[model samples]
Target: MHRHFQGLALLAVAAALAILAPVFCAERPAAAGAAPSPDSQSAAPVVIQVDAAHPTGPYSPAWNYFGADEPNYVYSKNGEKLLRELAALSPAPVHVRLHNLLTTGDGAASLKWGSTNAYREDADGNPVYDWTITDRIFDAMLDAGVQPLVEVGFMPEALSTHPEPYRHDFPKGDIFTGWSYPPKDYAKWAALVTAWATHLRDRYGVESLNGWLWEVWNEPDINYWHGTPEEYDRLYDVTAQAIRSVLPNALIGGPDSTGPGTGRAAEFLEQFLEHCLRGKNSATGGTGAPLNFISFHPKGSPTEVDGHVRMGIQRQLAAMDRGMKIVASFPEYKHTPIILGESDPEGCGACSVATNPSDVYRNGPLYGVSVAEAEARTYELARKNGVVLKGSVTWALEFEDQPYFAGFRDLATNGVDKPVLNVFRMLGMLTGEWLPTTSSGGLPLDDILNSGVTRAPDVNAIATRSEHEVDVFVWNYHDDDVQVPPANVHLNVDGLRQGRVRVEQFRMDSDHSNSYRAWLDMGSPAAPTPEQQAQLERAGKLETLGTPQNLKIAGGRLPLTFDLPRQGVELVRISWR
Candidate 1:
């Protein structure tokens, strides 16, 4: 550590970080439901090296998969604004997914719930398809240069076995009684799906629809599905056939089981794949279903301990590790694309800080850094498992008209961007092959999932090199909210063409690109004044940490050092003349 960093300025920064410790580490009453406090420590400086010339693989734009529960929210004022902002993040195709596209009701968006009355049958039992609301949802995405990862949906009223008890009011009531039931008639269900696909293909063009992935349903192995294992297999068979009838060679896969932990979800994931591989098709009476890709959900577990948030990032990563291992072990599906349909810090996106105190991190930089940590682990697991980790859809998007920093796992609260949203902006800026990177303080992937970063912060970074740019992303992450010492990073970048360079640093932390902080300073306004609103709007965007700096690289090596606060993420971009 002395060899990597030894300077008075560094010591001063370290001391200042110590002085500001209580801001992040102070204890609050358990009932106050505040964000967890990280244990205070004298952070050791981490030495990381980025080998730009040794490109490993393309930094696949797999991070663009975004979703939410409310389908109609796509066209809402806040939703439209957020969607367009998301589209602008990456040139790589952004695939949007949503729920309740086929449920029965007037289009109304709510927490943990949404509905679009897309299908109905008349008194004569004749099928009637209303593409109105669903089309609007699709149109909003398409118009913004975004596409869909079509989540072909919850049972519609006309076809559900028990449609009367719809509109789940979970965490508040038990109306989720019927939406989980299987279709009353398999034939009607198949026809409804066929018509839905045909409409999308016709309206959006077959070529465009072909580019999108058509997943059979959301998580069918949990409360999301009230059917038995064999019954879900049957549903998948018919749904796949129905979709393929219109969209030729349609991409489909599922079971979308909850994380492959040692329980019912894990068992269901294994059994579902077996059924897809060997069981007779319930629709065609042929062995195997048309499975192009496999999907599942892996969510983190955050528990309130001593009135602080101790995130279960390891639990989520372990689940993904086991899940990928299961898929890779199967010789036939070893190389198939894997989409973890719902990847989040935890389940229950609708549960806010209002009820769940552990979620207090949603308002600050913790959400951003946690996502960065998970993404790094996700890629590591993919390489270890040897499968095409296609996309891990972020299960939360925007909730329009909510109070500022409402503490849902959302990209934004009530239209203003959250710190988590800018993390993607930092990721979107990288476009090249991944450079070999090693960090002294980074935790090993296996060790992280097995235990978590309890003893020290996982100070890590990822490097990418393009023809004209070298991008480095760093984050300070730990499972517990204890305020660890600032990760003073001394990044030694190698393999650069020795010459003059320009370096720009962007940040997402309490004081930058974080509207939640700005809102809190303004008295946690339920409704901000016009000037406050304007202030938050500007605060919501991705902002630079400081002015760009000029430097020179001699003999293809350069070293840059910066301090990263707890739960903060930083990206340094270098370009040469």
Candidate 2:
């Protein structure tokens, strides 16, 4: 049956090629003084070098690289398939953080506890916490070999400071409301977290729970939290203390505010840290607050340029660098591990408008390119700043159950893996060792620095080494959508004698391993039938470029030249004989 499917798929691809042949054949006049195309004769292979020392550090192996935080929406039937597909891509334990888990009430006091809400109340009107929904979601994650980043968030319904307008309705036509608000009762909020932590300890065991990082609310500096900076500081102090009270060794940290270096995020983090180090806890009156780590959110802007989506990779990195510097400046927080809890290209997760919408980029090669470039840059920023940057979670995963293709900003669409997820799969297969490499005939970093083209032609590449394997990830992307001129990529690999090496490559682009375009080909998820569903499944499959085989190395370097499409990413893994 699988063979039959493969044959049919091949035929389909052949037909597609035939249809696209004309598009590929058509060409405009070459530029003035441009070299003519080579005749049917032999052409020299472009030599690129890969070095062993000047490499970017291994990708964050322990962080939530391909994780999302949409529990309420993902648990539904439609969202489930998308989540499962994302899990299957790199089933190696991932972290899926649940955002807005609490915040059950309509106002600050009316905690309408239910299955959707993480907390519940008894028949007697007393808050009777229920872990049914939380358990189900976590179970699904665990079953998929994914761990929960375990974001302890929004105040429970019974505890929110203002419950009258409890769960805010999804904003109309791309506008979101109700996510930003302060909890009605800080004590109640703290108690709920304590109870939730205690329950997890009882159920998942203290040691098991200890492995997870407990982050507080998301973007407390923005509309996500309505409380004042001082109020949030007090809230963090109480919440941290409560979690510690339940499980003293549990990893607890946050102020998870907006961009930590600028605006409200920086102020919130500074104030929060200062209070944790010095302010007396309103609940316990203790001088030393429970702050296991420091965290903040950094997001990029979404813009539609030249009919394509471009992510602000540099802006986010700049924010991250600034945030790290700010944290490092504090004497008390100098040693704290920093986590960019909700790091991504944009802030609004639920909006999916096609033209310049928050989620538009998720549907194309732009997402894959953005993620690969951002990850590489994040590592670079960390190295230059000399900070222990821990996890940089991609703020999206899969919406459990939504319309087949409602265009949500998630890693998967209707149970099909998007191109972005393929990037994570490539990252996952990488070994955790840094190698050295250089690029020639490419834009110099200084030129890029001065040009302020942070998003375009941002040639960020990284190589990881194991005793026997070398993995190289290269991405060509720019922030603003623009045509990137092809440049010779010269990669030099050193420190090894000529030996047999095998290369396995994976690529994510408009025509490869992209579920969004596939869905569109199947008439979009909005109008899906069983046949379309099957096709969507097939589309989600990550495509391999070539079979692994031995290559005779002339020198220590392997050289090749290929045209990289705009917003394209390539992962090459080489192993020696």
Best by TM-score: 1
Candidate 2 segments whose C-alpha is farther than 4 A from its true place: 1-48, 53-63, 66-69, 74-92, 105-115, 118-125, 173-185, 306-310, 354-359, 400-406, 441-456, 482-490, 521-525
Candidate 2 lDDT over 1-577, as tens digits, reads: 0000010111232322221110000011212243223220113212345666344455445334444444655555655665565565453556666665664532121111112366656777466777776776666665555567766666665555555555443432211234445666566677788888887788778767766778767666766667787777777777777888988887888877777646656877778878888887777877857787787776665544444444555566667877887787887676788887777777655554432232444666776777776666666566666677777877776554355544455676666667777887777766656765544322333333233243224444667787777777766666654444433344455655587788777777777887777776654547578887778767766777767767777756676555455577777777775
lDDT of 1 by residue, 174-196 (tens): 64557778999999999999998
| TM-score of each predicted structure versus truth | 0.92, 0.82
**Ten-residue segment with the worst summed lDDT in candidate 2?**
1-10
Looking at model 1, residue 169 earns an lDDT score of 67
Residue-level error in angstroms, candidate 2, position 284: 2.8
